[model samples]
Target: MKPERARSLQWLLVRRLILLQAGMLLFFIVLLIVVLSVVKPRLMIDNEAAVTAVTGAVDRDKDGKLIVHDTDELTQFRAEHPKVWYIIHDTTGQTARVGMAPPDYDRDLGSLLSSVDHASIGFAGKRDGKEMRPEAFVQKVDTKAGPVQVVTSTFHSRSDSEGFDISITAIVDMARKPDGTADWPRVLPGLLASLGIVLLPIILAMGVTTLVTTPAVVRRSLTGLIGTANQAAHIDFDTRAMQLPVKNVPQEVVPLVNAFNQALSRLAQGIDSHNRFLTDAAHELRTPIAILRTRAELLTDEPETLRLRQDIERLSHLAQQLLDHQSLDRPNEHRRVVDLAEFAGRVAADLAPLAIEAGYDFAFEPPDGKVEVEVNALQIEQLLANIVRNAIEHGGGKGTITVLVDRAGGLEVHDEGPGIPVEEHKNVFEPFYRVHPHSHGAGLGLNLARQIAQLHGGSIAILNGPWQGARVRVHLPLHRQTA
Candidate 1:
């Protein structure tokens, strides 16, 4: 539940989400590319065929005149159109062929007789005459212009046939019309099929991945929430607030959890203060109540009854002191700026008579003019009274009690008594902690003084003085400088 640990978990969750998204994007991109590449070529081929069919008539008209030229010219034109071929034969030696020659004809025009008795025409060669010798041949038709023959030759070319003399064949006749048109309906079906082959699996995978990761993420979130709750559960009322992880948590939950933690902290502080107050209050009242009870019990005897009444009166005064000590623990809102020097002078004058009775010297040395501090006047008076009383009672009844006030708004009460040991310095501020067990007064005096100092945003420290005595330093901020 620590803030740092929560932040780390949140970072991890973010990374996982990023990785999942990236993986999905990468998978889809690859699938799209593959589907498009496969389907694109077939689409291109179909488009090319459709364009060729649409422009076929235009091509035939543009090149029709070249086919009607002289036999030689027609033969030359046919040679240019190597994809088409025609054969012609004549009774005479000369024969004209149109288009490219067949695959097996010789380069030389030998055995010129085309058709003496019979002739054979093939992609490889043309043969004529009684011996059927190879010769330049052409396809002849009996037209209005008499028997016209277009002459052309054939040549050998490399073929897949191994070691055989293979020749090029002009099998496709460009003069012939194409048989069919392109099927446009195939476009949509083909596209859909390609998409299905490629995109469908990818989409399914993404869905599955999302489903799987959802539960994992939810579980992780729940686990983190539970962990935080468990840690909050273990928080001790008197201890400091627990640190909780804040990262990776849902935005909806953070504020509520944080508010709960803050409330718990405040509650713990209130409870600790209450418990300490109760314990100190009880301890402070015990001695006075015991004295009152003992004095009341002594009333059964006649001679000791009057002396016991005096003791009861003194017990009543001590009980009132205990009540005042309890009230000091509860702060009052009334505050004002008062000069420390004047304050110290008044407290010394009031306590001087008591010091004289106890055979102790009391002196008050205030700063020149005024050293103002923001404080509750009554509380400061009570604080000074407690310090003066403790010094007189514990100073061996003869040493001087020096009250020094400074312009810095600091006050020091120095008593010429054996200084407190350094080890007990911190403990002396604790409520009901007494340095001398056999001392007359309850041990709430110094602790109450410290509580008042703290309420005014000040502090008190016990240190060894230049002489063989204990010096109590009270440091309070000036009136204008509130902490």
Candidate 2:
């Protein structure tokens, strides 16, 4: 089965935060509009705003007469509010009236300008079947030209146009009923435009902020978990003492890490128990196998007796290989520097008799110079013995077995047997894996050799030889190191 595609935790977290922020902002905008719609909305002008608009438009004509000129604010106001009434009265007693109003306000503006500086001018009216009074802002201001009185009034649906907020004008204008009929086509567009004006910049700012900050926050928050995952990648039975650290981990993930640590502890305990059982069994079997070999030797030289002795000997060899393989995992106290060329020559000389007994010629070739290495003497001796035994047992029982050493800290054993198939090269080193399933050898030899070689910081591999045979090479990393 193929694995699922991996999703980035940081990317997922950032998307969630951005979506959460967007949801909140939209909710706030709707809530704001709802609250405003429920309140008593007004779009009235204040005395200060009224005076400033009026003063800017006040100027003298060519004949030196005070007049009111149309400015941008006044032009927009008049265009949207045709029913509005405004009267600009100057110090020269010339009054300019722009829109319709009750006769009382027009008459009072010119004659009562001296007495009234500010007043709420209005008339009695009925709205929503209730009695009400309209309101207009009247104020007098000093300008560059002279003093002028500005009376400004606006009409929407009611007279309660208090100076609380100004956006109410958009709502009123959208449904403006000057002919007692609402302008239905403009309502939706006007509402949408008002909302856009209020929300566009907020959306833009929040989008920028979310993009810039979310990934960094998520990555920093998960630093401890990432580190723990890195440590988990290299875990094995050899590193049973290793533990994952929880420093800077998030509070929510601490329990998960604790559970993982507890599980690892249980696994390490089981592995240790299994290894101890194997070591104990191998040691207990050695003495009985030795006794069995002695008794079997007493009756050998007959055909059936010879077969029995061979079986007993194979069992004894298997038991000893088990002991040797387990011993490689034990702590070493005899590691020292030895000349590999001289060392390989001595071990090969001792194994030559076995080669000759198997009907094969044996030879040892030493390097040109001293090829020294630091290793446990007993372990390397076992590793070399295993490789030579494998060659003698399977070297077609003919041809030559050659051991060669080089100055580069490499030792090779070449035999005139059919070379290992290319596909089985790597699998050959796995424990208990044999090319022929029923072979006499128990198959622990090469695997034990591999383990011992690795314990000394070296590696072993099968290479193609010139004689169409197996060339087994072992490379120790350094020739010699200071003790």
- Each prediction's TM-score against the native? 0.49, 0.70
**Global CA lDDT computed for model 2:** 0.78
lDDT of 1 at 10: 44
Candidate 1 error regions (>4 Å)? 1-10, 29-250, 255-332, 437-441, 481-483
* Per-candidate local distance difference test: 0.62, 0.78
> Model 2, poorest ten-residue lDDT window?
163-172
Say which candidate scores most in lDDT: 2
State how far residue 483 of model 1 sits from its true place (Å): 15
Residue-level lDDT of model 2, residues 47-104, one tens digit each, is 3355555677777788877767888986776675555666777766777766676554
Q: Which regions of candidate 2 fall more than 4 Å away from where they truly are?
A: 1-3, 37-173, 176-189, 331-334, 480-483
